[model samples]
Target chain A: MKKIIYLLILCLTTSIFYSCSKDEPDTANSIFDTSAPELNSFDQWLRDNYVIPYNIQVKYKLEDIETDYAYNVIPADLEKSKRMAFLLKYLWIEAYKEVAGDGIHFVRANAPRVMHYLGSAEYDDRGKRLGVAEGGMKITITEVNDLIPSQIIYQEFFNTIHHEFGHILCQTIDIPIDFRTITPADYAPSTWFNRSDEEAAELGFVSPYASSLPEEDFVEVLARYITYTPAEWQAKLTQAGTTGSELITIKLGRVKTYMKNAWKVDLDQLKAVVQRRAYEIQFIDLDNLGF
Target chain B: MKKNSILTIILSLALAISCTPNIDPIFEKSASERMTESVENVKKLLTAQTNGWLVEYYPEKTQKYGGFNLLFKFDGENVVVRSELEPLRTDSSIYALKGDMSTSLNFTTYNISLHRFSDPSLNIGGGIGLAYEGDYEFVIVSALETEFILRGKKTKNTIRMTPFPTTIDWEEFCQQILDSKPEYRPLYLHVNGNDSLWVSNDETSLTMSYKKDNVEVNKKIAYMFTPQGLKLYEDFEYAGKTYSEFILQSNNNLISAGSTFVPRVPPATWLPRAAFAGTYTLIHYTNIGGTGTPYTKTVTLTEYDNKFLLSGLMPSLNLDVVLDYHFGKGILLARQQGLRYIGGNSLNLTSVTNEFGLSPGAFYIGQQVSWDGVSDPIELTWTDYGQYGSPIIGFVLWFTNSAGLSVGQYTTGPVDQRLWTHIKMTKQ
Candidate 1:
């Protein structure tokens, strides 16, 4: 009877300790300010064109944190940024959207989250970094100062976009496993620059950089095929000769099959749209962001 | 054992009761609140000024590239900037005062006029991997109504922004400062009477060099031009005095804010004025009317400031041959020097030697008819009297331009006298 009474007292002592504290949650506003800023007309245009449909942010106003700290570079020119943005949409974005049929959804799903514009090219000890992409999320395009309304002038930019977009698609859905086996011995991971473009093409590679890795090779082939005209593509095959051309044709067929099966994109139809828009850029008013 | 256990239980109860912990915060606001307030206050101070702010911007960690002037005119989120490096260039961009590591004033947009310093363009500044290494984001160290102290985010160089004076036009002000750069080399920087620095500058690099311990010590100060003078990047401490500003004197010397530091040319005369001032005997040989006449006289040489005045060069007229003892060469009478100005024209000295023509030097002007210095310290090659009609080869009197010299301006003699003039002064 006394032991039972002591146990009851012990329970009472623990119950007394719980009475002072309340279980109420905090009502104070958050320390972080998440309020949407009043956007300028250009920013509003960016929102309507890019963010609304694709959820991408095109930042011409350079934040030092957004750029590579190691590489010394400057912010993109405003006029140049407008020109490049309009050109990118006209050539790269619209091309994929029109032909892929479902690629409009594919791009909306896999497009870069952020695109940074730089006025000067980011140069290192070896040479210039034309464009840099990180983890299929962000893409920083340099040489905005060199931007012009011409097919030849903005070729590197278009190639870089297609190349990086190809990477994004491949990252989301892996490239064919057999694509690696086709040119297993031709890969030069470190000394790719030693081979000339013609030499690399003879080894069933599109460009010298494509010989760096199997993954790079797949993207380079996809990028070049989309950017190059039929005449240009044939000219490359001519340089490759019969044995080289046979190997390249087999590789390109696999790549085309992979794009059709994995991402549902047609390479030939995409090129036609891209070329049509690439030609249309000569007439577009670059400085106008009114649309 | 029961008694010890009872005492321990009592002690535990007492300890628990005594430990009433205070959970209340000491300050009224949270850390975030304080940070937000600080950022707001800084923004207010930045845009408070009516005119603008003058920035003393130093690029690179070591400040090897020196400093430049960047003027900022802020209106809300917009900021317009101008640079001394490219005087005419003005670029407008957006800025933000953020609650980052500190309240950092970030130049968010591309300011070609200003951000070129930080750009690796391969054209401006250093090329490729090398750049001016300037900073666009400035961490606010302190903020006040009149001044805001900032530290570069990357370079960590201290940058000061003060209210831009509304007195002068920006272009003319910068032009005046650039024009005030040391026109000659080996300028003297006087710290005081005893301690001094022999200063030389490469204006292209904007670097000033001095010799210390027989080794060259270079200092590059980022400067801003005010109406009166230039302000240094920071207070320069040399020989127990701190100099932050320099005022341009009327004599083209820059005097430090403390009045102790002055960078100027110490008088070019090698010897003192007293050393060159004394009476002398004048010897002259005049060949006029085809007859040579030896004329000797007792002349007086007296000190006129740092120059010397001789009374017997042309004895017939009341003329004092003012000789400037300068250029580290004894008594350098440049061809620009004139004498006896009558109306607008003056009778100037035309001394010539074949080996060394009238290139400005401290060669002796003598009365000798020969090349030997033993006869007279000064000598000239006298041409034939026949050549006087064409070029006038010998020393002859002609009314030259009083203002200065031009190539063929000294064509005809206004005064028609073909007088051969020479002077010899023997210091006694």
Candidate 2:
């Protein structure tokens, strides 16, 4: 009688377990989609060049989730996006490749994971925003649609890329201690915008924004040195006059040495490569990117 | 005993099953499935109307640019949009239904008409950081076969859309609204069988004025035209009637939409001379010649010879002048002025006519002050007030309220050779 009672209790428990554990509905497809997006020719080019090589995602399509909700920004123009992509690859990526010698390794390691392109400048209450780099992972480039393949505009944009990249490089390996001490007394982070570039240069800084802090001063020197021609740089230094020019020269020397010792990269050689690529852009037919 | 125990177990199991109550689902599908279905339903409704839809979009939450009309055609993943923005062109762009907290319609590609409102460089709505503070992503609120309501994701502005009839010519319809802009003049609001409201446009905005307890109550709002009519940013309500839109009718009359109780009547051909009699302060002055900054001065217009004559001491020039004008024709008659440099040296000069070689027969005033209630009635004409008619150009005058001026501050000149000046004055 005891054996029969135990058997009946076991049967009831097993039946309850079976009823409760009926197979959950297959929600894999409903919850998350695994299909890849349909890519146009431009997207395919980005995938082949930037994505496959450096693992960088070029977001030309304006995704609200990826943007600063505070801003009212529009998507990059398809034509402009294509041109800018090619230009960036040639001027920024390719130039860095030549500079580092190990073309793929340098970018694959230090390059930002994401690059966002905006058609218009992200203007704020204070002023117009050019570009921003966050956490060494994402770099947002604004005013992409305004590119006209001109030398001045090209240098303006390339300077921003180099400036942001310089920050990324510093994040990987801290900025040299010597570079910070060069202009330790002149750093005015809050009121930097009020000062003109000439005034900043006179105060031993490369640009007005450089006077904001030691890190900014360091990157400004690196970016301005690479983008400016030898004559343009000399003119800037000459305009700095006397003690201001001497201080800028000392800061720049420290930057050059730091790049060489720390990253094994020659600053002058990188500038030459970047300048050569920039000149090559004028000849490329932007309308037809014969991919 | 074993059989009895088994029977008890069975009875207990049946009792437990009967004790528990079953609950039914309110919705037939899962939440995710319902969300997907709602997205599809919205998309279907949008694409159902083959002729496309017309949208009245208010980009700014503050309603700075008022409302703009957009004609949109959705087919597959593409959308063709048209508006009255610069270049007046149509563009085909990509669009998608993206799911966030709710399903949203996003213009994935750059459309000139849609993107201009978001371009900060354009500064359409005049705020910094965000141009016009508009939104490209709109959450689907509700939709019917013929109409839909969408709320801007960022701006929180409500956009109303209705299907465009195939018979309506979109371009012509938009052009007609643009063509209906009234000539710069005073507008009157006829309400309660009385022309009690004074309306004016200050080039950038529309202002309606009425006396409330002996104090001038002015309500100024920016406005834009739609296919149906002119829409004011703020609704004008009086006597239990609210008006935000007006349908254009014959004879430059605007009938309030949905009601005939309030209508905007055009200004009379001529205004009474008493309308110009007031003490005004020089609030703004500009010299196009890039010289001679305007100093603050008070000018009083007194009714003279059945017309209005401006009498005042020019503070900058130290000259006493009296000028007469025709209120109806907006003409400034030639006037002679007594000139004397005050302070250091006193050189009393004689009065002269054709003082600036201004064509003798009342140089048809380029810009004249009118009581049309279209703008500040104190805005005087752009006249040549040079010394000895030697083209030592004088400033143009704009006036506002003298006692506790509420408008903006005074401005100087980046003067041009043509001597274009703008001045603001206030009535005391």
Candidate 3:
């Protein structure tokens, strides 16, 4: 009996060892591309400014996995990518750092993890696309190659970045319930593109896209306020007329309070910093950013 | 005892399988190592050719915008690309061989000619909200010394690359085709020395109209200039006639591929008078001299007495006026006395100032005929009135037959000292 038991134990042990051996086929690991991304000056800059500090990955190289498979898109131009990187750091990151009074905490905690730059837009079936934020983790900005560093174009792009960042912030901590109540009856949900910004403003919204949803409205107000100049804000308000202007003013007051109470962010201070950076963008020597 | 024997057999079989060494790789290297090797080999092959490679790229799967020729010069990390699409410009950008599911040749950096096909802002391939649905990343299917065949990762369109000999200037070759003033004549494709197929080119596309079972069938194919000759996007066949390749000969005739006797006969000006006599609408008109902007306006052309009565407001001048022109066999003359005010019914000859004249107000200017084609195709060379001296102006006018009147279909280039205007007209 002892001899039989010993044989049984030996056989079980051998079979287990054979199954778990290192020689077992591992096709998955074998095929994986273990190589790192090629390091260049632009990549190094991205690593230092985005990856190291904020743990954000700036993917300027075209990766099919990171893009929309339905629409054809190519990688951003290297020169354009470099220029855009400098602009983003100067305008978005530093401006937030200036407002939150922490060099890394505000962005590191709240910013999207991945920033994807595409040379062309991700045009949908409707023949319109600007930028898209996915699950508050990735933000894709397209048509970066054509950025001319002008205030109008920069404001449009800045609005997108801030809009996406707002979603990240909302994901971390929900927007104040009172903020959604301000424009409760006015959300378009769809068909907002058919309405002009002036028309949207008249309906107690800051921009046309803001009228799409409560969340988009909250973000649009914040983004537009931060990026728009004093003149532009006044023009929007004036265009909204008396009743609409009053409603917008009430909504802005609620947003200001919500930022201060919830995230401890000063909306007015953030706007000032962003506006100053926006004005100084054209003078920044994008090519020779001494990183 | 029985259980112990079964366990022993299983153990012995497991041990036997485990003791077998990894089967000797068919290739000395492992599969991963072989993949890496292949990637390197492809990279080396790309950069090895000193004269670079000509890439015949079809951007769309449906093959809508035809094919384009691009010359690629590859270095270690960068590729310099040139194309006739962007005339006389070469752009250097980054390229990489990446291992995804398969080894891919990716133009990771934006080269205008390479990326324009994927740019969403420009709709070239008739794909809504998409550029041409072109692929920037291509899977290297087969690589050889003379040719490399690649399939687009996204579009799945086949792209072929072959070594471009240093002796040939690709730009000059393309420019020659663009500059060649082939008589705007109908070409006759003779098959087996019996059946004939009519061929016509609209400068951008080739159209073959033939009778099939007593019904007129027209097959339009998009084509581009190749180093050798003209390459059609799709093969054409009708009534025992089949050809997709043509070599331009010195005599301005296209000889079909693999044939010593087959030639596409150029139009011999069979019908000229009835060509320009039609009611036409301006589809595209550009004023290169002034603002250099194209205008799409509803302008009517009434042809009578060998004269074209243009009774509509010229967008360039913003005037609602009547202009008359006399077109002959190979000469189109603009009568100075033909300028008139539609409301006043009086001649306003002095309104033809230098700016106005240069603005297509030279409506009174005559054009010297260069090439005349069947169906009243007329290419006219005129002089710009505003330019200091009499600068020779060249323009091409194409007309198509309609019910009772011939319509002016296409026009291009009153190339005034290098500045050219393109005007397209369709029968209304």
Model 1 CA deviation exceeding 4 Å by range: A1-29, A124-127, A151-153, B1-20, B23-26, B182-186, B190-200, B204-230, B257-428
Candidate 1, residues B1-428, lDDT tens digits: the string is 77556556755664565435546888877787788889878878878876789888888776756677778988888898988767787788888788988789988777876777777753323433456778888899989987889999878999988898888656876787677643323245544454454433322222344456778777665555555556666666655666677677767666774553343443443232344456666554544333355555676767542245666555555556554433222232322233444422445555433322342311234222112233332322223222112322224334443224322223443222223334445656
Question: Residues A163-210, candidate 1, lDDT per residue (tens digit)?
Answer: 888888888889898899998998988767656668888888888788
Error of 3 at A283 (Å): 2.9
Give DockQ per model, in order: 0.19, 0.34, 0.31
How many clashes show up per model? 1, 22, 0
- Candidate 1's docking class is incorrect
Q: Native contacts recovered by candidate 2, as a share?
A: 0.53
For residues A1-21, what per-residue lDDT tens digits would candidate 3 score against the true structure?
768766766776776667664
Instruction: Say which candidate scores most in DockQ.
Output: 2
TM-score against native, each model:
0.69, 0.71, 0.71
Q: Give candidate 1's chain B TM-score.
A: 0.53
True contacts kept of each: 0.49, 0.53, 0.53
Compared with the true structure, model 2 gives a TM-score of 0.71
Model with the higher TM-score, candidate 1 or 2: 2
Residue B340 shift from truth in candidate 1, angstroms: 64
